[model samples]
Target: MRLILLGPPGCGKGTQAKLLSRRLDLEHIGTGDLLRAAIRNTTPVGARARPFVDTGNLVPDDLVNELVAERFQRTDRPSRFVMDGYPRTLAQAHAFEQVLAQWKLPVESVILMNVSDAEITRRVTGRWSCPTPNCKATYHVENNPPRVAGVCDECGGRLIQRADDNVDTVRARLKVYHNDTSGLIPYYRQRGLLSEVEGSGSIEQIYASILGILQPQGG
Candidate 1:
């Protein structure tokens, strides 16, 4: 059940990926998570990626490809996985194809979660989180505010919005998404591997929609 999730930053790709991975017993390979882990651990790739990350710039295709390639080379490489936030560009798509070919674990579907730009902006900009190392609880301004205003319900810490979650940054990220997916979406569609899912609904509703797409007929 190798899958690829394609969507803008605030389209709930991460949430859906987590749900699908658990339900299908597949590895959840999120490039964002991997990059964060690398950066936190100060690995070679992390060091190289930090400058770009700090500036809210997209990491180069070669660096991202190298990082993903290393993941695929691990002894416990994931044979069944759901990828989120990866293969963002045509170059990445091509490189990923080669890697999957090497592993013989071709993607069965590419889910493109669609959300409007305005909605994306709203969703991202409303997000706030606890910065405490032990409890990084997240909340949305409208949808899931903490019990007390500007406070973490779990840790009683002041909530902080990520720097990249600002409106301007989100708009920039969306532009990048549009540019990359202009090529990526077509690449998958032409291969008969693309599935479109609306990302505006509740998490469960969206998850159900995806399950309907992936499940065998009459299963």
Candidate 2:
């Protein structure tokens, strides 16, 4: 099933998407990751993508649509895909529908991993990442604190909160999410394709909730 994974920042959307992608045998297409990859590669796309990435704003819809369209057409493409971090606004949603209609692959469901704004702030503030450049190894202050304070378990590098992960930046990103992305809730609801999975539980529990929604007939 083609899917859209929806949630605020720190809502466990990406974690749940990764699990569901594996279980359902679908590729996980995270637009944020795509932009980051582009930036890292410094390709023509990256060069053009950098300005938008530096400031936490959604990329232009046309470019995003093209990237997603190209991914969907790959030869070894998954049976379906779980999309993360794309269609941050209603216009992108419209664009996505047009492209999917052209491909004749309308989304089967939109999974919403619901978490509150307060929870989001709490979750992000406590999070830390590996100090290795470009390696974002996330840890938590309360839930998953490192073996040693301010050090990554995997790389032995110091752990630090990402510049974007700080309170001010997280708040800015949250404002953007609330303003632009939340509209898709009603949009998908109108299509009768939205399923909400409570986003307050262990990763496995959350994954199970998502699976139940996706394959409601229980496979």
lDDT of 2 by residue, 188-208 (tens): 998898888889888889888
Worst 10 residues of 1 by lDDT: 210-219
Model 2 scores a TM of 0.81
What digit string (tens of lDDT, one per residue) describes model 1 on residues 29-136? 878787897789887888898999999998878989877887787788899999988888988999999998998989899999999999999999999999999999
Most lDDT-accurate candidate: 1
| lDDT on C-alpha atoms for all candidate structures | 0.90, 0.80
Candidate 1, residue 90: how far the Cα is off, in Å:
1.0
TM-scores, in order shown? 0.84, 0.81
Looking at model 2, residue 128 earns an lDDT score of: 86
* Top TM-score prediction, candidate number: 1
